[model samples]
Target: MHELSICQSIVDSILEELSALDPKPKRLISARIVVGEFRQIVPDFMKEAYKAVTKGTDVEGSELEVKTAPIQGKCGDCGWAGDLPMGDFKCQSCGSSGLKLDGGMSLYLDNLEIEK
Candidate 1:
């Protein structure tokens, strides 16, 4: 699963940043991430991946907090714009298929909780 690689990347990035700090953190508490619905990431899989990838690493024992991000879309037909329901590409106002979607495709670390 790609979650493993994603977890590895997160760990690598966190460790790199932690190393640059003047006062290193005593413990990593959690890594909060936003998982867009459009990305179709399984939270369970992500947690499992994090557990596997973090073993023996500096961030080991840290939790992975996942948050779901809604998909936003604009209807070209009705000029409507708002957050769209997942998998529903049509506009709620006009029910048009001419919807331009944004967001909900991202996978990024939102923040890190560390004990200093």
Candidate 2:
């Protein structure tokens, strides 16, 4: 699955960050990632992929905490700004279909806890 590749990228990034530390961390404790609702990521699959990819690595028993952000949008016609339910992009205030998605398409690492 693509989750494996994603996890590999995460590990690579973590290692790169760790290398930059004055005194490299002894081990990785956890990583917090913010994933937007619009991203089609399966948490279970991600966790499984992480476990597999991190085997025998410094981050081997580390935890991955995923935080999700809801889809937010603004209606171009009505100027309504709010969260949009899945598959329902129409504006709730004026029933306008012209919406501009402003959020919920991000995926990035937010925080990391490590042992020094």
Candidate 3:
């Protein structure tokens, strides 16, 4: 699954950051990531992927915390902008279906909890 590759990338970044530190951490407790709803990433699958990818590494025992970002959009018809309910693309204020989605497509590592 693509989750495996995604986790691999995150782990790579973590290792790179850890190696750059003057005193590398003894252990990684957690990795917090934000995933937009539009990405359709399943949290369980991502966690499983992280566990598999980190096996036998310095981050093996770390937990992956996933935060879901809501889909946001702007209505072209009425110039309304706000968070849109998942799967509902209509503008809440104007009842128009011409909502231009501008958010919920991001995926990034947000924080890392490490024991020095």
Worst 10 residues of 3 by lDDT: 16-25
Give one digit per residue, the lDDT tens place, for model 2 in 1-116. 77678888888888788788878888889988887888878888888888888899878899988888889889898789999898888897998999898668888888889888
Q: Scored by CA lDDT, what does every candidate get?
A: 0.87, 0.85, 0.89
TM-scores for candidates 1 onward, in order: 0.91, 0.90, 0.90
For model 1, the stretches where C-alpha displacement exceeds 4 angstroms are none
Q: How would you encode candidate 1's per-residue C-alpha lDDT over 1-116 as one tens digit per residue?
A: 78887788878887887788778889889988898888888999999998988999888899999998899999889899999887778999999999999888888888888899
Task: Please report the TM-score between candidate 2 and the true structure.
Answer: 0.90
Worst 10 residues of 1 by lDDT: 13-22
Top model number, lDDT: 3
lDDT of 3 at 56: 93
Write model 3 residue lDDT over 1-116, tens digit each, in one string.
Answer: 78888889999988888788878778889989999999989999999999899999878889999999989989889899999888878999989998888769989988988898
Better of 1 and 2 by lDDT: 1
| Candidate 2 runs further than 4 Å off | none
